[model samples]
Target: MNKKVWLIYGMLALATSTWGSAFIAGKYAVLSFEPATVAFLRFFGAAILLFPIMWIMVKNHTKPTLKDYGLFAILGLTGIAIYNICFFLASKHAPVIKSSLFIASNPVLIVLLSGLFLKEKITKNNIIGMIIALTGVAFIITNGHLLTLFQLGFEPIDWILLGAVVSWALYSVVGKIVLKKYTSVESTTYAVAFGTLFLLPFALFETTWQDVQLATWDAWVAIAHMSVFVTVVSFIMYYQGIKEVGAAKASIFINVMPVSAVIMATVFLGESFTFAHGIGAVCVLTGVYVGTNTKKWTLFKRQNKLRVQTKDSA
Candidate 1:
C-alpha cells in the first residue's frame, strides 16, 4: 500500500518471474548440453558471483568446522547437484510448464517433511491442502485421467521432476539446521561451491572441452540467465523481500513463478496450454494458498474477535 511495500512487492514479483524463466532457459540449455553439463555450468557460474557477495555482505562470518563442511556437502548434494540434474533432465523430456508446476508443489512436500522430521505442526488445513495439491499434480501428470495411474505408471520424466522436488525438500530441511549456524547467504554459497565440485566429475563425463567450446550462443545465454538472474540477482531480491514483508507474504509471490513459466513457455517454446493444465493450475494454486495461509487467517480472525470484545466491554 505504501511506496516501500509496493516496491518490495514489485521486487518479489520480478524475482519470482526470474524463477519461472529458469524453466524456459533450462529447456533451451538442455538442447545444446547434457543435463549434468547444464547443471554444472549454471551453478559453477553462480558460485563465482555468490562467494564474493557473501564475503562483502556478511561481515561477521564465522569459519565452518569439519561438521559444518559435512552439512554443506549434504546441502550441495541434494539442493544443487541432484536437484538441478533432475531439473534439466525433466526439462529435456517434459514441458517446461509441467516441470515448473512440479517444482512449485515443493512447499507441500516441504511442509509434510518438516512436520515429520522437524517436529513441526501439521494442521488439518495442511493435510487437506496437500491432498488437493497432489491431486492437481496427478491430474497434470495423467492428462486429467486419474484412473490411468493404475494402468500406466508415472512417466520417467515425472519421476525425475519428482526427484527434483524431493531433493529440494531435503535441502530445505537440512537448511534449517545449517541456518542455525550460518546466514542463508553463507549456507547457500557453501552449498553451491560443494555442488559445483560434486558436479564436475559428472559434467566432465558428459561433456568434452570440444563440446564446451562448440556450445551454441543460446545455450550460454540460457546458462547465464539461470546463474545471474535466477540464482544470484533474484535470490538477493527475494531475500530483501523477506526482510521487508516477512516470509509468509514473501512466499505468496511464488505463485507467480509457475504462471510466468507458463507464459514464457507458451510464447518462447510455443507450448500448448491444455484444459488439463488449467484445471491443475487452479487446484495447485488453491491448495498452496490454503495450506500456507490457513494458520495466518485463523489467527487474524481470532485477534479481530478479541478486539471487538474489548471494544464492547469498554
Candidate 2:
C-alpha cells in the first residue's frame, strides 16, 4: 500500500512476467541447443551484460569481503547454475505447464524451510495460505484429473526438477543472510558470476563447437530473451523486491508465475487454457492474497505509528 510495498509489488510482477514467458523462450532455445549449452549461454550472457553495471557499482560503493563473495558463490551455484540446468532437463520430459506448477511449490517450501532454519514464525494464516496455493497449483497441473495422481509416476526429469526446487529454496534461505552483508546488486552479480563459472565445464561436456554454429535464429532469440530479460533483469528486480519485502512475503509472488505462464503459452505457443486453468488461477490469486495480506495490515499500522512518532519528535 505504501511506496516501498508498491515498488516491491511492481518488481515482483515484472520478474514473474519475465520468468513466465521464459518457458516458451527456453522451449524454443532447447530445440537447437543442448540443455546445458542453453544454461551456459544464458548465464554467460547475463554475466557479460551485468559486468559493466557491477563494475560501476563496485567502483562507487564499498566492496564486499571475501566471506561475502563465498556466500554469493554458493547462492549463484545453487540458484542460477543448478536450477537452470535441472529445469532445462525437466522440460525435456514434461509439459511446460506441469514443470511450472512444480516450481510454484517453491514458495511453500520456503516458508517451511524458513520456519525450520531461520526460526521464522509460521502462523495459522501461513498454513492456510500455503494449502490454498498448493491446491491451486495442483489443480492447474493435474488439469482437474485427480485420478491421474495414481497413473502419474516420477521420471528422472522429475527428480531433476525436484532437485532444482530444493536448490532454489536453499538459495533463497541463504540469500537472506548474504543480503545482510552485501548490497543486492553486489550479491546478485557475484553469485551470477560464480554460477557462470561453475556452468562452463558442464556446458563444454554437453556441447560441441558445431552445436553452437548449428543453432537457429529462433534459438538465438530465445537465448537472448532468457539471458537479458529473465536471467539478468528479472533477477535484479527479484532481489530488489526481496530487499524491500522480506523473503517470505516476496516469495508469494511466485504463485503468479503459473498464471502468467499459462497466459503466455496460450497467446504465443497456442496452448489451450481450460476451465481448470481459470479455477487454478483464482485459487492462486486467493492464496497469494491470504498469505501476503495477513501480516501486511499489522505492518502498515506499525509504520504509521513510527511515522507519527518521528513527526511529533521533529
How does each model score on TM-score?
A: 0.94, 0.81
Tens-place lDDT per residue, model 1, 140-239, is: 8888898998898988898998899999999999998999999889999999999999999999998988888888999999999999999999999999
Candidate 2 residue runs with Cα over 4 Å from true position: 1-12, 58-66, 237-256, 296-314
The CA lDDT of each predicted structure is: 0.92, 0.78
Best by TM-score: 1
* lDDT winner: 1
lDDT of 2 by residue, 220-309 (tens): 999999989997788778877887787667777776687787677778877777787677667766665565566874587689999999
Candidate 2: residue pairs that collide: none
lDDT of 1: 0.92
**Which window of 10 residues has the lowest lDDT sum in candidate 2?**
284-293
